[model samples]
Target: MSSPQDPYQPGQPGQAPPQPPLPPQQLPGNSGRAFPAPAGTYPEAGPFGLPGQHPPAKNRRKLWIILAGIGGVLLLVVLGIVILINVAGSATNQARGLADGFTKMVIGGQSSQAYDEYLDPALKEQLSKEAFIAGVDTLEMDESCKPTYNDLQVSTDNGVKAADVAGVITCGGKEVDLAYRFEGTEDLKMTNIKLRPKA
Candidate 1:
């Protein structure tokens, strides 16, 4: 049999081969077992990857939904503004039409007819046909008094929508400023009329 210190010692029956010696770095201070080597930097996007930065599929979908919600709100606001503008414009035109019709009557020698047919009920009660005709006549209203309607402005007072139709009426050889204010723009009626000679 080989001696215990023999180089051929492993020739003994059932004896395993000797293990290679660990490196000096592998030694655990006085402890029989060695500690494992320190690990290197983490794998690509491994532990350093935060939750929502490059996010999972589900989180990405949530972000898209939030964007869509904002887009929908903006679309609704634009549509509402367009619709409001159209309604206001229609109201102003309707009120202007009423004022134009009344002005035409006064210019066409039908002041009494206009007062009976177009004036608000409350105003008609306060001013009789004679009084209304007398009012129009004060401007020396005549065929030579050419009326041209200018810009019509709009406003609201006490929940009553109104329009002020401004125009120049040449009367008695003088240019006069004419303002016809109407109320109830929805079902417009002449509320007031005034004529002033321009300076």
Candidate 2:
């Protein structure tokens, strides 16, 4: 029979045949083809290697130590400046105080007190208390004689030096020229004083 007329022929209203499903895709291997690596996997070689790697603890500690030393040096410099300022202030005060004391004793007619304050140990031993007091008393008794000292000016000259003291002596209302020399010690004591009448 003529193949029974193909009972399920397309033209004779028969169901179509089913097609096969597509295969799943796959990445290539190291066989001359590039492929994406799995997440979190890294290449053997890198442009720089492990981003932001920290320095060793020892190296970091050394850097901190160097900075600390520099800071300490700066601190010491500041402290030195403060100490020098204090010393200068103390010197100024001492000079002013000594000058004031001399002025008060002389103007107040306290010749003995003035002598005691101004004379150093050496001078005191050389000149007896009576002689020293007498000399100052003579100056006080003179009508035109007046002794005055401005504030002491201190300066460094190998050591410390006091400014020239101003002195005058008057007799019979005539001014008498007086020459004097003054010296001080580190402790600001008036260590030496000499007076000479002008010719």
Candidate 3:
């Protein structure tokens, strides 16, 4: 029988024998006792990437830059539209003034000056100065009455700007509807003139 202090001694009947304790495992670069891995090693992985790596600062900054670029482009577009509208309005007013001045000069017996200044080069090429003056003379417009314009419309087609002025003027004490078409926003010269006697 084994002594009571023997490590491998069996206990009383129906009891199992005792086994010796296991020796400590010694890894190449570690102490006898194993330690848990460092906190940085073998980081937990998630669907996107490593855990706690969601919403990176670099990606957030890029998103903000993209949004800012879009906003800047939109601002520029709005400013450009505003500038275009103002320019078009200025051109319309200029055209209206030119039409009024030209009509008054012709009816006020300054046909020579009107033909020299207001008529477009293309129109002058079609009608001689003598013919224009003769045509105005036949109208017999009252120089005392002021011409009144009812409507002025400006438009652009294929990069060409044009304006139409429609109004009424007194000729021999009779009201006459007169319409004038002017072309070119910058140069602004008269292209056509029409007179209709009102019944």
* lDDT per residue as tens, model 1, 124-172: 7777889879877876666767777787888777878888889888766
Segments in model 2 whose C-alpha atoms lie over 4 Å from true places: 1-52, 55-59, 137-189, 195-199
lDDT of 3 by residue, 78-109 (tens): 99999989988987798788988888888788
C-alpha local distance difference test of each model:
0.76, 0.58, 0.80
Candidate 2 scores a C-alpha RMSD against the true structure in Å of 12.6
List where candidate 3 sits over 4 angstroms from the true fold. Answer: 1-55, 157-159, 170-173, 184-186
Off by over 4 Å in 1: 1-55, 143-145, 149-151, 156-159, 171-173
Q: Which ten residues in a row have the lowest lDDT in candidate 1?
A: 43-52
After TM-score superposition, what is the CA distance of residue 148 in candidate 1 from its true location, in Å? Answer: 3.8
List, in order, the clash count of every candidate structure.
0, 2, 0
Query: What ordering of candidates by TM-score runs from best to worst?
Result: 1, 3, 2
Worst 10 residues of 2 by lDDT: 21-30
Model 1 lDDT, full chain set? 0.76
